[model samples]
Target: MKVAMWSGPRNLSTAMMYSFAQRADFAVLDEPFYGPYLRLTGLDHPMRSEVLGDRRKDAIEVEQSLMDPVPDGKPHAYHKHMCQHMIDGIPRSFMAECVNVFLIRHPARVVASFAKGYPDLTADDIGFDAQAELFDHVRSLGQTPVVIDSADIRDDPEGMLRGLCETIGLEFDPAMLSWPVGPKPYDGVWAPHWYTSLHATTGFAGPEGPLPDLNGHLAELVARTMPAYRALETKKISQSMKL
Candidate 1:
C-alpha cells in the first residue's frame, strides 16, 4: 500500500514521517518533490543551492518514482509531501492509486511557527489553500481522503494513530508512537533549515498552549488561510469519529 500524507509547513509532518518509519513494514519518503518545488517557484529558501544540487528537480520523474513499487521490498510506502510542492504542471492523477491523507495544524500556530524562519511568508507559502484544493479534488474523484489535525495527534498519539491506521486500511503498530532521536536516511536536504526542533525529539511533543498574536503581514496571511483551514477541519478524522 502507498500512502501520500500531505501537509503544510511547520506542521508535525516530519514527526509523523518518523512514526511511520519506525514500523518495519513501511518505507518512508521525505518531501520527494521539494527540490522540484524550489526549482519551479524560484523560492530562495535556506540551502536552496544544496537542495537543487542533490535532489531530483523534475516533477514528472518524481511522480513516476512515487508510482513505482515500494523501495527495498517494503510492504507499505509512507510519502511525506508538502502541498505547496504540487505547483503548476505537476500531474495529480497518481493520487488515485494512493490512500491520501491530509495532516493539518491550526492556522494561528502554523503562522506563528512558520514566521520564525520565513519572515516574508504569505498565505500561499503556508499551503492551507493548496491543501483545501487537493482535499476537494481527491473527494471529487470519489475518494474519501483522511484528514488528521496535528493537535489531535499530539494529544492522543496512540488513539489518533490507531484510528488513522484503521481508516487507511493498515494495522496500528505500537512502533509508530516513537522513533530514534536524530535524523534518518529519508530526511530531505533542507532538514537543517526546517527540522531543528524535530531532530532533537524522539516522539510527538505535548500540545502547545495559546499562540502569540500575529501582527502586520503575518496577521493578514493568517486571515487569508483561516477559511481554508476551517473548511478542512470539518472533515478531520477526529471530528468525524465522534459521529
Candidate 2:
C-alpha cells in the first residue's frame, strides 16, 4: 500500500516518518515535493537553493514517482508530505491510489514552534487550510482517510500506531516505536536546516510544555489557522487505548 502522510511544518511528521522507516516492509520517501514547493512559492527558506537543487522541481514528476511501485519490492511505501506543497496546478488524481493520512498538531503549538525557525510565517505556511482541503477532497472520493495528531502518537506510540495500521489494513509492527538517532538515507536535502532537534532523539519526545505567548502576526496566524485545525480535529483518531 502507498501511504501519504500529510502534515505541516514543526509537527512530528519527521518522527512519524522515522517510525515507519523502522519497519522492514516499508520504503519511506521524505518530502518529495518540497523542492517544487520552494520553487513555486519562491519562499527563501533556509537552504532553499540546496533543496531546489537536490530534488525534482516538477510536482507532476514527483507525483508520478510516488504512484510508482515501492522501491526494492517493499510491501508499503510511506511518503512524508507537507500539506502546503500541494500547490495549484498539481493534480489530485494520484491521491486516489494512496492511503492518505493527515498528521496534525495544535495550531498554537504549531505556530509557536514554527515561528522560531521561520519568523515570517503565514497561515499558508502552517498548512492547516491545505490539510483540511485534502481531507475533504479524499473524503469526497468515498475514502475515509485517517487523521492522527502528533500528541496522540507521542502519548502512546504503540497503541496509536496499531490503530493506524488496522485502519489502513496493515499489520502493526513493533519496530515502529523507535529508530537510530540520526538522519536516514531518505531524508530530504533540507534536513540539516530543519532536522537538528529530531536527529538528537531516538524516539518520540515527551509532551511539550505550555504554549508560548504569541503577539502580532504570529498570534494572528494562529487565529487564522484554528478553524481549519478544528475542522480536521473532528476526524482525528481517538488515542484512548490501554497499552
Candidate 3:
C-alpha cells in the first residue's frame, strides 16, 4: 500500500516506519521531506551542516530540487517529515492513492523529549505550536488521517498496530508487532534517540520498559495541544467505526 506517515520531529514516526517495512511485502521510502524541509526552513538542525553541505547552490535551488519528480521504485513510501504548516503548493492529489497517518505524542511528552534529547531546540524550534495547528487544519480539511499516539504505540504495539491496520483497510500481520532490530538504510535523521528504544525489541511488546518522563516544558506543551489532540483522536475513533 502507498502510505505517507506525517508527523513532527521527535515522535516515533521513524520507528513506526521501521515496523511497517519489516514485513516482506513492503518497500519503504525514508523521509522524502528531510531535504525539502531543510531547504524550506533554512534553519540548522542536528546534522544540518552535513546534510546540506554544498549540496544546493542556494535555498532556491533546494526548493527546486524537492519540487522535482519523485524517484521511482518503492511501492510503500513512508515519509518521515514534519508537517507543522500546510504547504498549499503541494496537493492532496500528490498523495491521492496513499494512506496518510499523523503520528503524535502527548505535547508534554513530546516537548520533554525535544528538551532533553535535543537541548538546542526552543519551543518554536521544536514546532509545538505549529504542530498543534496542523491537527486543527486536518480537522478543518475533513480528512480522516489515522492519528496514532507515540506513547500508546510504544506501550501497546499490538493493539495500536491492529487498530491502525483496521482503520487503513489492511489485514493484521503479527509480524508488525516484533522484528529483529538494527540499523537500516531508511532510518531517520534522529535515529540515535529512536534506535536506542527501537533497536533490539520486536513488536509493540507491551509497555515492558520505563517510559520517558515529562517535565515542565512538556507539561506546558501538552496543555496547549491536548484539546486539539483529543478532538482529532475522537474524530479518528468515529471514522474508524464507519470503516
| Per-prediction TM-score to the true structure, in the order listed | 0.96, 0.96, 0.73
Model 3 residue runs over 4 Å out of place are 53-75, 85-93, 124-142, 189-197, 208-219, 236-243
* Top of the candidates by lDDT: 1
Whole-model lDDT per candidate: 0.89, 0.88, 0.59
Compose the digit string of candidate 1's lDDT tens values, residues 1-105: 999999999999999999999999999999888888888899998899989998865888888999998999999999998898888977787899899999999
Q: By how many angstroms RMSD does model 3 differ from the true structure? A: 4.4
What's the lDDT for candidate 2? Answer: 0.88
On a 0 to 1 TM-score scale, where does candidate 1 land against the true structure?
0.96
Q: Which stretches in model 1 have alpha-carbon errors above 4 Å?
A: 239-243
lDDT tens digits by residue: candidate 2, 145-175: 8898888887778888898898888889989
Candidate 3 has what TM-score? 0.73
Model 3 misses residue 166 by how many Å?
A: 1.5
Cα lDDT tens digits, model 3, 199-240, are: 775555454345456556555665666665565555443323
Ranking by TM-score: 1, 2, 3
- State the lDDT at 163 in candidate 3: 83
